[model samples]
Target: MSTTAIGINAAIAVGAYFMTVRMIPRLRDMFIKANLAGRDLCKKDKPQIPESYGVLIGCVFLISMFLFIPIPFAFDEAAATDALTGGKPATFPHDKFVELIAALLSICCMIFLGFADDVLDLRWRHKLLLPTIATLPLLMVYYVNYNSTTVMMPNFARGVFGTSVNIGVLYYIFMGKLAVFCTNAINILAGINGLEVGQSLIIAASVTVFNFIELALGHQVESHQFSLHFMLPFLATSLALWKFNRYPSQVFVGDTYCYFAGMTFAVVGILGHFSKTLLLFFLPQILNFLYSTPQLFHFVPCPRHRLPKYDAKTDLLHISTTEFRLNELGKLGRLMVTLLRSMRLISWQELEDGRVITNNFTLINFVLFIFGPVHERVITQMLMGFQIICTLLALFIRYPLANYFYATET
Candidate 1:
């Protein structure tokens, strides 16, 4: 915290925000001109919206990293001295620069996949596996720069285990799992206009707040400051995207936005060395992921998109699920569906054609089940509101709540 450092970071954040905001229209026009729009046949009155506008975030972020942020701050004297060549000054951002490069490459890979999916319309299998590839670069970086991946136990349990419980090499596997889950969580819990980008914005803002709080508390200043570096640009660009991507959207962020936003979190978590803390902010996304796991794993028929059923007259949305015919299933299958329907876990609707309709298995549908039919925007708000509450709860639990259950690991 020097004033100079504070001023420099603030300038970079403000400048990046404005630059990205100004460029969104240009990016949207480029997508539209290139015929990059989503097929909107799934929902009522939904129009084809321009896709891959999320590339603006990557572009603006990388550009700001290079153009504004200097290589060596006052914090890099040791590096500067180590590189005391014939007056070739130390490079900026220190070792973290390498992590930035890895993050950029990984994000580019994700954006490429998203663009391919948008243009070529790849299937679920491809979507599931491609993001794993995007994470390889980031994961490799984390492996090379080794650190603790130990999960903290309760104090008494830690005494028995001789400190934090180390999961050993299995931590890499866990990181890989984190990467996959983060990439897909936001992607799975989306279909409406603002829900995708809105959640991203909220998560970014939450992380930003966490970073600032850490900085203010005089704890891990440099690391939290580094986290802010990513969070600020993300929040900046996402706010601009949200304006056009809101209800009655001018553009569709598409799979690209989800892939990009999710991986951004992955990058920040890995590079900032706060992966555990980072994961806490994503509890809602994680819960939604868990809630939808059965459908995602194909226990039930998972539709390409779990968009709510829109009522034209009421202007409200209802749950949309796959239904099975009685004749198509054996006794056990029929019994299972019957029980789930009775529990209201799955809805059963009688069709005039002697068939049945079942509610879609997703958090969006679950919200409607609890709250009854409501507008899509309301659903977005409630979910986003829940995300905010979860994030604040995470903050509370990370500190105050820890006094009872467990100690902070690092």
Candidate 2:
């Protein structure tokens, strides 16, 4: 089978998976009005339909297999040429069968997990166990066909490990541990409504950009053969899932979808031979997590807990305690103050004592943003720019924008 056929097939399968998942909410509503015994199945005061929605979605993906599997595969000659000529074009693996199998396993695992989580509310232990078991075949396939050398300081210092090592016992242990970490990280981020979906967009965009860079470098064979095959399909699946996952979310992706998506990404990074690049793709989220770590450890207070939970939904760790505690001011006044505090335009103590504290924490993030990547590469520069923009926007824009929409209602 050709690379083009595989790419097209994967796209269709993912598209179908998302389209079907989107129907869950509507189905739930119907079930609830009917006074079904399963009304309790939906947890959020919102009705939940049967696990049949998952089955249906899985079926759509299954049908795509028949549609895509048979077409004669052909590589994208144009993409190959572009890559060789130092122009970026998205490319896929020459061996379509391996990718096809990986995608199929991914879809199936997602459907299974989605159904279980939606109906049963599976425990954390079980969630870990199930995905770990499912990830083995994928790990095997990845090791069999891909290189596992740790490439540090690309095009410079590098360590080459034989394919024999990749196929050995030790590689499986490392892959298993990495898979669990990534999948859980995605699940943790999926805790809030719209957060996972929003973050996924950023990740997908980054990966797509990386793929474009690889293509432009005219090294399509190296990039596409080992890496993009998995990444592209994973990105495609996430994009399709986002349709159902956006605000006023119709269907929660549940553990199933999140786990599958995370595994796909984790495996792709491992195979791509670009662990460092994967870190770059996830930079924003990593920073956010780090910023929040102090609060998690009780080193600092989280102000959102002091406010009405719904109204305080967007509060990050950086938000000050004073603004969070102020209730005498009207909602609009409170919003303006909170906005200022979040941006680090004003200190929490200043808002509390009616005087600004001279020192602040905002600059710490700014400095890290500038120096983080330790390189002058285009991607690093762009990321640094994003950090600055995010800092400014968080301080100056997001609050006002949020206030405009939520003031009266909250």
Candidate 3:
């Protein structure tokens, strides 16, 4: 049954990939005709590219997933039940259908929100909180279907918090927070061609790899299978988008794609019962978010766009910076900035006056600061390489070092 399902999903994914590639060119004209376009600031001419093309990918993915609704049950019902329930007494798998519905609903809500944002250009504060509303359906489904809120404690901490800690309502709150974080993390880390779609691809591939491992080991097969159902088509459509959004980009993915990609990860992680493992794949994003905190929270002056500055003469991207007087910062803020500079996390030039010129806190800018000015494409590739490295490290920790930290039944 798993094999059959896998084959079907692969077919769907391939179809989605081809469909997206074929349709994107046609849609590009429509998007531009509708005035849905943006200037690619990294290029010298700042060419106008179709924007919000992520909505197209989202639409394709949703359609593919919707078409797959019947594949699990199309086979022998008893076999499907046994597979879904891990060989428990055979019965119809109503819960699986419910989960699918809820997942679709949540993803649909996110797509709508993302499209609205592209059209309306909502405030950053609003975008940050709107994802929570989109997650309500998912949380409700989780509570009603499989509310296992307890988390395993590390061996070192077990004595203090017990072997398993049931965080109760806090677990749901945490899930909500996770959704918010996932939705925003990709959006926050985005700039340059293909970076958003590129990072998402790496994370999705990492999650898919993790799912394959779990399924092969016969560990939580149903949960992992559930994750694959959404992830495969997502990866397919995203790959198609990346081909155009890559260096020398022909179209812009816009904030819509970021939100949709983030929501897809959140849905799979939450429902697949491997939220922790899923988070491991986002290590780079987490670091980026942490690094950007001061600017995000207004401790430092943040430009509307913290994108790496393009040096047209050199045809390279340099670290983008913000200038402010040192005296303007509160003592704590000043201390924090000084500490970051001292640690080389940030680079700054003390101006002739009391003002300070400091690099904007972003992973893209940080990469340029560390590696020196390079083409936009090089920086993106470097970050994607970092993402792959993080995934490998995460997998090693999850599989090998896990036993040393926590007792588990393999």
Candidate 4:
């Protein structure tokens, strides 16, 4: 593609961004009228705000995709851009078309699932389980269309054990797991105002930037094209949501945005054939999920909302704690708590009444733990900064691994 093509593509992306921003007010009003608002529980005032603007955000992305890369009958731009085709229909790679179709189907599945969760206020258990079905198309496409799910072992492992070991069918299972984890990981590491979408924006931007660098360096063109197409729209809608969701939020995105945003990334990762690189980009969210696994598994009692305690007076957020009585615990419980405390992932205070309060296990709470009590806004920015740092680190690390273990068209 030439500079003129690049400029045209960018204009389309900017138009999508502005279009989503323009749609938010109407969506906000719609949520309000439907009484789908949620209280800003992190704030002292606990003001009600309309929720699930992701509906429109998803709309913008899907619509933009149709316009930007139309299905055969969707539109005809052959006359304008197909000088080389010379009246022959501009043809897309069959594999690329299949991947994009699968991606679109997967994202659509996620959008409807998110909307249902937003309206139903589904439980965490249901949230985890429901997105599995949404990922079926993604997994099925990978198996039928892409076919090979075998992953090569790391370079170091190859030197030690032999040439790269194929993981075989397990790789498809891993892809399915990746889809579920990506969707839920974002959902879990959220609660702070704009933190969810803010981190998402940074991740999308980082992936997009990395894709461009790969392109400029002359790596695989098709993979990079798929990545840019998926990410540009995701970044646009996320930015638009952040506009309303920042600091003092005008609207809450609820679960709908989280599902849509996360699944979109998953689709890009799978279709672009950069799923491992994609996981690297989400290192922070992955770490948060691992850190919170004890609670997730019921080793520790998990609260419906584990958000940091917000003090309105100073506008600072404090780490919130969950109570677990040591006396009520078995040997396994005592050991788990001690291990987490030793890792400094949690701090606990034993009460005279036999209950112990353990700090909330999340990246947001962990930031509060490390930085001390900071303004809610400050913490949100700090976490987003961590997101950027992690993503950049991933980019730097990916090339070495990809070159040695995963060969690509470069």
Candidate 5:
């Protein structure tokens, strides 16, 4: 096994061991407190430590160690960057070890941030800055090897779509911004149990599949083939996390786990030269964030401690009227009024109110996932057709449904 791989395996073991021994109990207490405040979704009648935690952690660590230990067995250590980049795969070496260290530092930063958020309620700006800072080292590594000649967009499309942009300083800035955006996207979804982890597993699996395809196509750069080595460890880790993370869970993955997990996935995607593919894989979550941007303003006026008022006349809830029954519009309207009367909107409350937007976001995402793989021309046509159908549905059905449930009853 390569020394670097062995060192990484050792690191994982040490880190996991220390975390399990020192952090788990404290985390459990934090979850308990959050549950008391109704902030924790996983604390509903669940055990303090779910059996899944032990199983998942054990399996993930063991597998990662096993896969990572024989790095020397896989590649030569003394090769140059040119040798590796020139399409000759070398054995696992110090460079990869450095990558793991970067990942570990990112994970450590995330953990610290999560702890602060949980205890002190850190603001959004801080959250943004932390991840950006954490990613600077990785960005420097990228800067050193970046290709200035690579076309970001086609020359012909420069006028219309602005595709002729070069990968310059602005490109790195945008990349950093994208990394932060993705980190928070995963964070926003962390409110629900198992949702973030499940979504991540799906993304990881998708990327792994893509990587294997590249490998199978004999797209080798040097002696090293495009392999699933990095992703496999992450996949194993996530699977282990999911054991305790599933619905009605015991232990929460916390922002510590969630943020770093997302960042790790993002870093791997960038390193593997599949950032666009990764974007496609998480397209649903990305769409969710896009749709929620507007609602941030709408929910801002609402107080933090109370639920925000819903305007029955215009602001329609996505739920169907049939789901809540009263033959008369007045009675149903009264029920809706009563529900909103008890709710208030605060900064934290906006997070919950934002769920509706997130759901719609996911629905749009699902549509994209179903149709995203097709050629651009075909997708545009399909979207046009779908828009027409949606227009008709809204005009004929959804509008009436809203009128029935939300219109002022005389």
Candidate 6:
């Protein structure tokens, strides 16, 4: 029965992939006609491309899931028996279905908010809080379902906080913050062609692998199955989008894709009961966020767009820098800069006068700095490679090294 359901979902995913591909070009002109377009700033020609077309991906994904709603019931022999014999009517996974509906509602809200952001160009602070509103349905579902609020503690910390600590309301708070973080994480680490979509694809693929592993182990099969159902369609739509959004891109995914993609991962992670494991897959994004904290918090000057500086003459991208005067740095700021430079996390240059220039705090810029100037496509491939490496390390830590930290395999 599980195999049948998986086969059906796989078939639906294939259809969604083709649907996304076919609809993009047709919708491109419509998007442009609606004045939803942007120039590819990194390109030499700066071609005008349709933007905010991620609505197509979101719509197709939702429709695909809706079509799949009846598959599980069709395959459920117990439910079929119950219906015929008028036995227990509760044979169906009605609770799981409710959770699915709530998850879809939250995702739908995020898609609407993303499209609104694309159209209205929402402020940064507003974007930070917007995902919280979208996450309310998910939180409410979790509350009503009475999901576990206890978290496992490491062996070393067990002596201090016990083996597992239940934080109750704080767990919900953490989940809400997680939704906000996941929604914004992809948006902040983006620039260049394919980088956003590419990284997101890597994370989605990683999560899918994790789900499959858990399912195969017969560990929390239902949760992993739910995660897989959401991830397969998402992966299909994202892969289709990547084909057009790659280097020398024919279209831009815009902020809509970022929010939608982030929320997709968030939903699967939160509802799948593996939020902690999901975070392990986001190591790169977390590092990037930490690296950009000073700039993000306005301790240092930040530009509206900190994308790599494109050199049309060289036809390559180089590390973009932020200028700071010697006097502008407080003692702590100067110490932090020096520490980062020493750790080789950032490259710093001191001017003849009293000014300093350092590579902007972004994974993209850091890669460019480390590798020197390279073509946009090359840099994107490098970062994708980095993302893959990080995810692998995360899995290793989650499975193998986890035994050392916890009393048992986590």
Clashes of each: 6, 8, 0, 0, 25, 0
TM-score: which is higher, 1 or 5?
A: 1
Q: TM-scores of all models?
A: 0.86, 0.54, 0.95, 0.90, 0.57, 0.95
How much does candidate 5 score in TM-score? 0.57
Error of 6 at 185 (Å): 0.9
lDDT of 6 at 387: 92
Tens-digit lDDT track for model 1 on 1-410? 24355556567768888877787777766777788777554356767678777766667766766653453255355445657655665556535666767877887788778767767889888877887788888777777766566877776676578557778878777777777778888988888879998888888888888877777888777667767766776777778788888887777787777888888888877777677888888998888876676567765566776888888778788888786566776665566666766777766788887787777778889899888998878898999999999998988877887765567634
- lDDT of model 2, residue 162: 27
Report the number of the highest-TM-score candidate.
3
Q: For residues 270-323, write the lDDT of model 5, one tens digit per residue.
A: 555555445656665665565444233332111222111222444311211111
Instruction: Report the poorest 10 consecutive residues by lDDT, candidate 5.
Output: 316-325
lDDT of 5 at 60: 45
Query: Any runs in candidate 5 off by more than 4 Å, and if so which?
Result: 1-74, 77-97, 147-149, 152-164, 220-227, 297-410
lDDT of each: 0.75, 0.48, 0.89, 0.79, 0.48, 0.87
lDDT tens readout by residue for model 3, 326-370: 789877678879889889889988878878898999999888888
Give me the runs in candidate 3 sitting further than 4 Å from their true place.
76-91, 408-410
- What TM-score number comes out for model 6? 0.95
lDDT of 6 by residue, 304-354 (tens): 889999899999999999989857977767777778988998888889987
Runs in model 1 lying further than 4 Å from the true structure: 1-6, 39-45, 69-94, 159-162, 325-343, 349-356
lDDT, residue 164, candidate 2: 20
Q: Which ranges of candidate 4 are over 4 A from the true structure?
A: 1-8, 71-92, 400-410
